[model samples]
Target: MYQRILVPVDDSDTSRQALLEATRFCHNQHGKIRLAHVINLAQFTWGGAEFVDVGELQGNLRQSGRTVLEKAAALMQENGVEAETTLIEIWGGTISSAIIEDATNWPADIVVMGSHGWTGLDHLLLGSVAEGVVRHAPVPVLIIPIKRKK
Candidate 1:
């Protein structure tokens, strides 16, 4: 049970917390992890001729994503969890979609991730990626949420 765990990581405290939780979950069994980082290219508006500096900006995003994945992988290693990393770049899609697609392809037993646990105005403004994952994920999702600071 839960032999293949998929974790979506970012450079947030909640994301790190999720990674740690996944590490703990995989420590006892013959479990392995696939760490995923999704980058949304649509957030950037690249205009002007020659595509402006779009390529450079995209490169930066990829680098940043790679760094995040690397750190997550290192954390898993520190906890003695076997983990691999994948980066998904989408020009016009939701992060949750990318995550679910990967989870399905990897055939993960579960998805362990961290959520901001936003609510009220914050939830409305930021929207919840974890909520989307919980709604549509092919595998069971374990969301580790960080408390909101006042």
Candidate 2:
């Protein structure tokens, strides 16, 4: 019974699954889907060289981000789901804050996202973005773990 659904996506396969799931849910509930992709400026920028030209690189990455959003939007369209999408370029920091900011600012009813399924050392070392979002989000959060095939 979700009205306005929010799904944060990246270029990862897990995010892709989230998109698909959000689309299906939107179709079932006749809700509007808000697809968002946050571009972390630090991660998107190239480092190492002090004198290296980064303007072109940043521009290209922004363009690529747009393409990704368009692609996701196309998937929703093909599935006969009406959706509105936004691409946000934010400074690199904790993803939790960024996600929470979007949820609060956009005033999303619920957040639907896919867990990266980190385990063992990776889980401990990197922690979980999904978990952070769940803990900090003002609204309900639905985290879908990617089904790994054996």
Best by TM-score: 1
At residue 85, candidate 2 shows an lDDT of 81
Model 1 lDDT, full chain set: 0.90
Residue 35 of model 1, lDDT score: 96
Of candidate 2, the 10-residue stretch with the lowest lDDT total is: 44-53
The residue ranges of model 2 lying beyond 4 angstroms of the native Cα positions read: 43-49
Error (Å) of candidate 1 at residue 21 is 0.7
Clash totals in order: 0, 0
Per-residue alpha-carbon lDDT of candidate 2 for residues 68-115, written as tens digits (9 for 90 to 100): 888888888888887788878777777767878888887789999999
Error of 1 at 80 (Å): 1.1
